[model samples]
Target: MSDPGLPPLSRQHDRRLRQMYRSAGWPCQDTVEIELLAAGLLERRLEPSGREYLRVTDLGIARLAQALDRNRAALDAHEALVLRVAEEAQRAGRIAYRGLGLLAKPGERWLQLRPDVYSIRNTSVEDYLEPVVHEIKVRRADLLSDLKKPDKRAGYLALAGECYYVLQQGIAEPEEIPPECGVMIASASRIEVARLAPKRPMKPGFATWMVLAKAAPCRQPLEPEPRL
Candidate 1:
């Protein structure tokens, strides 16, 4: 529970924090964008140092003053939503996360990456486990925008680990005691445990072969040319 005197994380606070980060001139510009959107501030462009950008808006400074007076407990409570949902999903035999997604690659590099709520379920079939993919989307009524994106989800999935559950939340009223929320689930998939196991050291001959492979590219093409 938040302190009685503490204020909630309003969109106003979000804008203020963003202004703070921007004025500081951090190299990673998206950090400010992510923080602002996560806090539900006015949606802005992903660009850095826009032509109309101001060091700090009058409204932003006022909000920051109010935030400084409030207890920090509210901020901690709000961020815990991610771990809380993951724990609940784990109890139900599902892997869940708040804002992790997947990325897909074209050729050797990823073309797009998307981030959202992701979950996976393990399915058993004749002693084998397969992973089922799930995606969660959040849409706020006031904003009329769906926060879910495929690239984000793809990026999360591309990572080495697997997650089996997801919960999406959209806050309609930033000032309300409990912000409005929504959730969705992805269909479950079986997980392959054997593949995740660490591999044993190879014999000398195999080790030597592996060293050779690493030292030089394969003589033949890895893939056939695509048909026109």
Candidate 2:
């Protein structure tokens, strides 16, 4: 737990603290440093030659650990939801990939976008592949932050015939998301579709095809051995 008496620190502060702990404590001499120093999370040291460097205090280490734990928990939640989505796709006879990177040109500039879950219908016909992109968010802050990036959303739209946002339950209402994208709310029991994503006609470019060919799709679960 953070000390209530101390000034609240942001993730940037935690990041700087970790960087300083890893490196030779070269000071950035910025407001983040001042805030950390004020909160006693960092201390300054002077050598005999008058060179000054920064050091993270014990309290800072504790804060870093806390941040790491929170991040890990969020990551676990995100990955679990991603796995569920991928499995759901497989059950629907689609080939799904997690963490697949691809280039998208939503605007004049091409952007690199890695949709949390990318899938295509399992079919022999290339035109019938129906590529889809699913972006997962377990945290409201992350979802809101992503919403602010129109270019990123555009990039996702460019790559898929259908784009969806799979959010943890209660993070946000379906109305909060843009109309172009679909919304799925995930709970402990099941995932429910809040809104259907509008489908568009799209053909995966040669680059997308190359990447998909090289990457592995999520494996289907194994069946139990038959009893004799």
Candidate 3:
């Protein structure tokens, strides 16, 4: 058979290759196995015990390194988009919080909801604290997957005075999001507000209060709220 042209591997493919590099007994998915073999990234070798095992070749390692580099670059770019949104919010005098985790209960450590970026306008008892949540969507597949989680949106609505979807240009249509949600676009040059989010301040329950409490001063310095 002729050689199959090697393309940039997905994160999963790169992970599998790394697993193979570490251990010959690494489990292989059918598609990954076929692609790795065809792409000349992996091979089956007989061990001293006569057991056949999969291993990543030098070429595979090189490709995995390249894949890792690409993954890092993509992550950096995505993070830049997130940072820009936060900066905009802050410039408007909103206190920005990135990766704020909302839990169902104060005792639980698990996240019930995690908005990519969220902000609270002012910090004190001055006026009603308006919470705005931002969900960043860089890929359409990821956006579609998130839209399926109605509970997440509902959770945000419970706490948010406004919720906006910060997305890549053309990645998602405004209709794809719920009517209650607003949309914004983050591109190479600037972040634009396509649809302004309506203010619908809700009575924040204990959990929502916990989210805001954690957002104070800075996202990193604040600790999780103690169980009430």
Candidate 4:
């Protein structure tokens, strides 16, 4: 839990803090800087030449460390879920890929979408490939933010026959997600499908086929040796 007495700081504040820590500490002279100064996270320094610069205080460094740890933990959780989804797809006899950057023209403008897991059925028939996209989210804030972007959903729909949102358990309910997408909740033990995604009759474009051809799919885990 955070201190209720202190003024609330957002990711933007943490980002600025990291930027100042990495750079020469020249002030941006923006509202973010003002808030950081007021919060004692930043201090102004006067050099002998009368030039002014900003410096991160001890408190700021501590805050930055905390932010980094939180980000790392979130990333770990996200990646774990991504691996689970990919493995599940593989078990279903589909070829799965992770972190593939594909171009999608959901509307008039082309957008790049990197789904957490992209999979296609293993079949010789092109129409039966059934490409699917699985987007993983471990944080509620991230899930909510993604829900607001209809364009991103459109891009996923454009690239795959079905799109699904794989969420960390307790992050959200299936009803909160858009009707067009399916929802799956992942716990420590297993993944449960909360909703089934609607399957549309679609085929991957030439660009998508080219990208998949050039990229490698997720490898299956090694099986244990039989007992002697």
Top candidate on TM-score is 4
Give the lDDT of residue 157 in candidate 3: 71
Range of the 10 consecutive residues with the lowest summed lDDT in candidate 1: 190-199
Residue pairs with colliding backbones in model 4 are none
TM-score pick, better of 1 and 3: 3
Q: Candidate 1 regions off by >4 Å?
A: 1-60, 67-78, 94-103, 106-148, 153-228
**Which has the better lDDT: candidate 2, or candidate 3?**
2
State the lDDT at 26 in candidate 2: 87
Better of 1 and 3 by lDDT: 3
Summarize candidate 4's per-residue lDDT along 140-191 as a digit string, tens digits.
Answer: 9999999999999999999999999998999898999999999999999999
Order candidates by TM-score, high to low. 4, 2, 3, 1
Give model 1's clash tally.
32
Model 3, position 130: C-alpha lDDT score:
78
Q: lDDT per residue, candidate 3, 125-160, as tens digits?
A: 645667788999887867898899777777777667
Task: Summing lDDT over every window of 10 consecutive residues in candidate 4, give the lowest-scoring window.
Answer: 1-10
Residue 151 shift from truth in candidate 4, angstroms: 1.0
TM-score of 3: 0.77
- Model 2 Cα lDDT, one tens digit per residue, 1-228: 455886788888888999999999888999999989988899999989899999899998898999999999999999999999999899889999999989999889999889999999999998899999999999999999999999999999999999999999999999999999999999999998999999998989988999999999999956579999
Backbone clashes per model, in order?
Answer: 32, 0, 0, 0
List the candidates' TM-scores in order: 0.32, 0.90, 0.77, 0.92
The true-versus-predicted C-alpha distance at residue 79 of model 4, in Å, is: 1.0
Candidate 2: list runs displaced more than 4 Å. Answer: 1-3, 222-228
